[model samples]
Target: MLTIVNDFLWGQILIVALVGAGLLFTIGSGGVQFRYFGRMFSVLRRGFHHEQGHISSFQALVVSVAGRVGSGNIAGVAVAITLGGPGAVFWMWVIGLMGMATSFFECSLAQLFKRYQPDGTYRGGPAYYLTHGIGQRGLAIIYSVLLLVTFGLGFNAVQSYVVATSLQASFGVATWVTGLVMVLGLAVVIFGGIRRIAVVSELIVPLMALMYLCAALLVIGMNITAVPAVLGHIVQSAFGLEQAVGGGLGVVIMQGVKRGLFSNEAGLGSAPNVAAVAHVPHPVNQGIVQAFSVFIDTIIMCTCTAVIILLSDVYQPGASDVDGVVLTQTAMAGHLGSWGAGFVSVALVLFAFSSIMYNYYLGDNSLSFFSDENPLVANIFRVLVLALVFWGSLQDLSTVFGFAELTMGLLAVVNLFGLVWMYRIGVRLLRDYDGQLRSGKETPRLRTEDWTDLDIDERAWRD
Candidate 1:
């Protein structure tokens, strides 16, 4: 079943979907992630002000970051290294880099096109952006359903699995116990809604990420002298130019791309859902916040994971018994002993725990959109999500992760296609933002009725 789902998920269909969307976005956006990378911090400053949106720009970005930066950076990194060797890390880099433009463009579209409420709130994402941006409501419905299943149910469930697996591996906890505890915990947060999720993420994401990176980088820095050679090995192995054992060029490239996409979720259209809710004056403003998200998730966090693996020299042949987080722990243990393994156990729990809340809120908001704010439908989605928490925690997580990956890969291909159509819109928005900056404008407004008709997120303007 696992192989079959993976075959379908990573099949030629998804391969085309994943790569085609990113490639198209890369060309269409003029490589915006890198072009705008230096400006992200400044743009992010907009998040500091209170706004009229659902959440602060920083809060929304962090909420999405909480979701995107989870097990993928940790266990997912180990999986990529285990299967693809060091060369795979190179492919992951390509995805994170190229994927950011996709993320920025999508968030820009979502922001520019979202629907605002009379109560000074907003709602948008693939459904709103695809429908409004592409002028196709039908396709938007299709996209929403896919997202509902994928990110809402599928990814959240996978998060539970990572928690269960990590606990089982490191602490000998039963999967049932893991599932029940998580279900109860997730239920509490999901019931609290996006604001609560944002708050929790604001607290947990920074601390967990800081702790994880500090631990990983300590190991990487210790092996700093071996970094160059390890990078060489990764490059040579990626193309199978150096001849890896029991795998070919396909395995090498796919592992990195798969894990990397899972890491930052730039092109996957998931983060933009949260990005749509962030309170920013301009669409591109949120885009910059998202651009930094990709860099942080992959370049900083996942790179740390890759560095530790490389430095530990664990990509050696026939190393299949240890994979995922265990592989990462082994690498850490080699450098830091048992204490390092303890850190992995704690980090995975926190990372996966935070992701559960992120996914739950995303799913809830998505359902609210679909139901046109019908309370009944909203309640059902929440109930179903809580139910899945137990199902996911106890059951094998790879099942849900596999399905979610397929859904995300499909959405990226479909959504990126639509994003290409928004190029003219992006140019106009960017020009508008630049004009404001040039005018030495302390405060900028979205001059278009198009912006007002959609969601009005002006929290950045609040005191």
Candidate 2:
């Protein structure tokens, strides 16, 4: 079963889908992420502004980041290092740089195509962009179904399992206990819709990320001298030039690309769900914000984790394997002792909890993508998500984590296709946006092909 599952995940289709689409997006937009790297920080530091959409840009970014900066940054990186080797970190950096452009393109299209719903809110995503940009109803349906399957079931289950397992180990609690707490919390936030999700994410994601980053920083600072050797090992191992603490170059590259992309999810189409709700003059404004989000997730948050592990130097030249949250805990223990373990446990709880809540919202949107929402189906999916939490807790690492990663990769393929289909729209939007940037105009309306043709009077927008 594991072989079949792993094979199913590692097959040609997913590889082509993820790699091809990613490369295509990078080339399509002239490597926009690379060009815009330095500018991303200026955009974020400017903070949220008042616009005409449902939420502020920062809130939208926060909600999206809530999903991206997940346990994958911590445990996921460990998994990458375990399989792909130290050089995988370099691949991750490649993914982060390229994925930002993909993210920018897709999210810009989402904002461009979004519908102002009858309830004075917004609704859109890969489904909307695929339908609106490509005029492929069938494509939208297929993408929505895949997103629902992957986000609602596969990723949700993985997140719950991580939470439950960590809690059981740390606090000696029942797995079900953690699942229920997550389920109830998720239900409450999601029921309020995008606005509520935005507010909650903005408040919680920053607080949790800051606390965790601060702790990791202190540990890294204490052992700052080891940084050079650690980096040297990463470089040497990446080229197969030397044997560092990690294992395989191919696997590491794949792992870094995998986790880095997973962490920020720029091209994966997940962030656009929240992006569609933001009120901004130009779609690129949100795109800029999303780019900043990638920096925060990988360049800042994941780097902190990596640095701490390196600084601690917990792994001996020949020690039994320790990966995932355990590896992180082990590294921290080298510095803070038992307190390090406790810290990661607490971090996992918050990280997984925030992530699960965001995933639930994604599932909810995905459910709505079917046209009509069914209370029965929604409730059932929620229950299954919670049940999978227990299932994840009980399963062994190889089986459960591999299964989850496979599902995530598959689902990401679906989302990436939808985004890739909308590339033309993004280009045109950016063209107009670039014009405005050059002109320095106070009236910063986006460039549109046919402003009057917009679905402006969309129910709540009944002009």
Candidate 3:
């Protein structure tokens, strides 16, 4: 029943809504993502701005990236190629481009509606805005619960399962052992607090991404002559009128859009959880940074994974028996020998580890909305998370993935409503931010009084 529902949601509803929302926001924002694309780096260069309850913009970037760029980039891309064929890669790119806009709007709205905790930390997300901005407590509660289930629990299980599978395949280790090790490591970080998670993400996200990209570069360099042909093949397969290249056009579009959404999560409403926690002068700045995250995840890391697999002899389109992580591992090993598999196992550990932590923070943030004063709620959740890690490590790949898709699709549909409902505020915030940037100031700050109509926390932006 769950699988059937997810198939319809992902295939018919979400595929359309996801792409449509992204394109809609892209137009409504005056293509701010592209217009201010160069400025994204400038904001990032300004770096961490320490505040009482907020994280630095760069720290937010890494934490969000930790969630965005994960086992999905590696395993998910392989799944797209296997089920959807090479054409899926093209669709993934399309979604990534449009998703930049969706991410910007959602993150901007999150920041705009953010509230402060008594402990001085920040809190906000689709739930916060749905209640505060639109005055819909029921909708807010629904979104919070959906977020908790989808990312906090379901997605964490998927990450653990992916890494556990990779380690098992590469080193002949027991999955239970991997699960035990993962639980211990995760318990230490998640129990340490959100800042500790941010600190770990800051250090690990960049290092792991660079190492994997470098390895991919080596593989691509070795097959330099075939690079142009592979690009042409991807384009041709995507639009091929016939069954010349694997899964035809329909499968291509479906797999590409689905996996791309899973990997980049631009329209999925997950990034805003971390984005809203950033200490930025303006919400639009963090929006841009989060938008940039879409590019990094899909355009860079995912593309690398696709190239490595497609360039190697290990990948065969329409191979139903192919293991997603194993396909990627085989591709790497094809070029780097035995050490390649080892490297993939290690990379998956790092990528999935940071992702698990970020995923926990997202869930932890959602939990706060329900029980701001209940420490026991958080403690119970921690135990549940650890238990899921072990249980997921031992579960079958098909079941874990199916459950993840169902939860994530539902989460996306709920959050997309919040984005479309709050569209005006997002645009207004963007315009105000642009106006400040164009005013020739070294630093631009948002003034809450300018928009007294919206229910913004005035103290958050007060200088």
lDDT per prediction?
A: 0.76, 0.72, 0.86
What lDDT tens digits, residue by residue, belong to model 3 across residues 373-455?
47899999999999988888988767767776787787888889888988888888888887877888766778887878888
lDDT of 2 at 132: 71
Model 3, position 213: C-alpha lDDT score: 93
Q: Give a tens-digit lDDT track for model 2, residues 1-463.
A: 8667655565445545666766887787777777767766666655466445467878888888888888878887776666666666666766776777777877877777777665667777888877777677787777677677667667777777777888788778888777777767877776666678788888899999998888877876777788788777777767777544444455556667667776777666778877777776667877877877777888788777777766666644324574678888888878887888878988888887777777777777778777465777777776776666556655554555566566666657766766666566677677777777689964346544444465332332232
Cα TM-score per model: 0.90, 0.88, 0.96
For candidate 3, give the lDDT of residue 236.
82
- Separate clash counts for every candidate: 7, 6, 0
Name the better of 1 and 3 by lDDT. 3
Question: Tens digits of per-residue lDDT for model 1 on 102-200?
Answer: 777788778877677655667788778777776777877777778888878898777777788788888899988998988787777777667778877
Q: Looking at candidate 1, what is the lDDT of residue 455?
A: 42
**Candidate with maximal lDDT:** 3
lDDT of 2 at 164: 81
Residue pairs of candidate 3 with colliding backbone atoms: none
RMSD of each: 3.1, 3.2, 1.6
**Where in model 1 is the C-alpha error above 4 Å?**
1-11, 239-241, 245-250, 397-399, 438-444, 449-463
Pairs that clash in candidate 1: 50-459, 51-458, 51-459, 52-459, 86-234, 87-234, 114-455
**Comparing 1 and 3 by TM-score, which wins?**
3
